[model samples]
Target: MILIKYIIRNHIIPFLFACVVLISIFLLQFLMKFADKLIGKGLETIIIVKLIVYNLAWMVVLVVPMAVLVATLMAFGNMSQNNEIAIMKASGISLYKMIIPPLISSILIAILLVYFNNKIYPDANHAARLLMEDITRKKPTLSLVPGVFSQDVSSYAILARDVIQESNELKDVTIYDYSNPPKVNIVTAKEGKIFLVPNQKKLIMDLKVGEIHESDIYRQNVYRRLRFTHHKIAMPADQFTFEQSTPGGPRGDREMGAAQMLAIVDSINKVQSSYQKEFNSKIDQIIDKKFNYKPIDTTSNKYIYVKVEQRLRMLENGFTDVLNRIEYNRKEINRYMVEVHKKYALPVACIVFVLIGAPLGTMTRKGGIGMASGISLVFFVIYWAFLIGGEKLADRDLISPFVGIWSANVFLGIVGILLLIKTAKEKVTLNFEFITKRIPKSWKSSDDEIENN
Candidate 1:
């Protein structure tokens, strides 16, 4: 009991410390990239804080496994360096037994992480996505600077000579209305005020003492002119207002839970099955149409030929549509499958890291934040690289999601097993000095060859 407690204490402290440090580093990196989007947007403080918190869920998912690796290396390395492991082994405690507590702890952590990935993380992703979309929809505080063209509203551009910020008005405003194609419409207003109707998603400009000039290419020699004491022009504010995406409906793969993803995959499979059935039906219809042509004695060859050609073209188009649908469903399935496997695969990495880190720590026999961090970075990068590569291959349909997602874990697990066995059997540490000694004397460097010459 005491030994187990000691082992856990040693692992947990470093694990907690690494988690905090790594999560902070990752969050800072995320903020650095996304800060530009949020800054100068006039967003509320609560919204900004919520966005940051929502993004942290994914960061936690990535950092936890890395923290596990770091903690294991640091803990075991410390023990080995202090000869604690040697003493434990002398007392009939094997390395395998010594690993039981930390390994079990990592398993628990993995289990919790899996739940977090499936449940909490999806909601965070959804919220973040929605919030980001909302942020993207907001206009940049409607700053219509003097001598600058403002293209905030779609299909129209506004150029102002003087902008009075206090009254939210513009003087000597030239409005170019290009909503109509092949015609250039211009409105010159001595005074203008622009305001947005958020609910209607419309931008309205109230112009005073304005003259409208319009030219049509078709009527090259004619022009239309109109003058108004007060005129209001309304334009669609699609560019200014946030478009809520399919509200209260299903979300993307990353924003869905395991059950939701499974449901989506099942639906996609059904869609593919339906497409196959439709394709088969279309083939049958085409075959029937080809053979069931009327045997009219009075029908000319050209007429019959044109009819058959039209039927064949329709058949070809049907076949193409079916093929495109099938291909689309297949790609969709691959995306969902990759995401589904990723949820569990990433969490399992914590256990795989333990297997590798424990033996490596004992072998390396060095314990320090610097040493642990350096080694963890190398291994984690290799693992992440494999993961990203596998995901890409899976996405491209070159490999199954299972293989793409689990390959890293399987490969590293094998390596960990081999290392565990070697560690148990007391294998000698690799020595670079021995390799240097074994080098042939005749194999000399360029400097040595120059000296000999």
Candidate 2:
């Protein structure tokens, strides 16, 4: 009973502390990439706070496993280092007995983590993405300086002779639309007001006393064009923000909506089928001899044959590549499908991480927290590597999601078994330097070569 209290006191608290630290570091890391997006956007403090908070959910979800891993390692490592683990074993207590308290704690943490990830994190992530998309469209107006050319969004160009900062109003504004022909539609406004769309998805430039110009450059090749201008021209609104599609949408591995992913799959398949049909027709031409490959002029025939063959090969390869992409996307979709079954699968993973962590901590008798940490990190690395490899394979249409997401777990389970066997015999389960030495000479790159890459 005393030992159980000791285990709870020493192990669980440190693990949670470590989780918080890991989350902080992850937020810092996630935010650094988008420094430019946040800066110079003239966003309100509340909006900025909301954006940052929302973004943190993704970072937190990603960091949970790592936090659990490090914390377990550190807690167990401390136990071994302080001789607590040894004392437990010496008192006729088995290694398995020592693991129970920590395992129980880890399971609780996992449950809490899952609740946060599935519920709060999803809502926050969706909100953040939408907020950022709105800021993207809103950037153009914010970047508009009184006397400078500001290219905030890539699609449109706006030139304002003067601007008012207080109301975000523009004076003598000229806007250019380069989307399609009539390639240059120009708008000049005596004054303009930037208003957000009703759903806050788009930015509307409400031009007061504005003239719209349309260019006529192509009239069946009498292209020496004419241009016309209009009074009171209103620009179309920007695209909607990143709202979660209706619930029934297809989702893929990245946890996209199911309906959305299925729709994409259909689109991709259509493209693949189109390419396949085009390739088949070329093959038919060769087999049926409807067009002679034999050219009376040897040069023209050779040119045609070479071009045709190259085109056919390209189309054939493209078709196969598309099929592969579909296969890979299917794997990703499967991973996302796991989300639908999260209540079952995730609880099991939480249980599994504890099992793996306990055995791992016990096997390396020395180096306490240090060894536990190293071991945890190594296993996690292997786990992450398998996940990445599986995703790549799926992307190449070589594997499925069932194989990809679970491959890391499968490999960990094998290692867990091996370690368990060694621990049962009171033998070391791992040698820190063993894997390094086992790497083949041919595969090892020099430090300089690694740096060059």
Q: Which model scores highest in TM-score?
A: 1
| Candidate 2 positional error at 14, Å | 2.3
* Candidate 2 per-residue lDDT over residues 64-169, each given as its tens digit: 6666666666666567657777787778887677768867776786778667755675566567666776665544454677777655534567788886655767
Decoy 2 TM-score against native: 0.60
* Deviation from truth (RMSD, Å), model 2: 11.0
Listed in order, each prediction's TM-score against the native is 0.78, 0.60
Off by over 4 Å in 1: 139-152, 158-175, 179-247, 281-290, 298-310, 430-453
Candidate 2 regions with alpha-carbon error over 4 angstroms: 141-215, 218-335, 338-347, 363-373, 395-397, 427-453
- The positional error of residue 353 in candidate 1, measured at the CA in angstroms, is 0.4
Candidate 2 overall lDDT versus native: 0.62
In model 1, state the lDDT of residue 200.
46
- Number of backbone collisions per candidate: 0, 14
Residue 30 alpha-carbon offset, candidate 2, angstroms: 1.3
Count of backbone collisions in candidate 1: 0
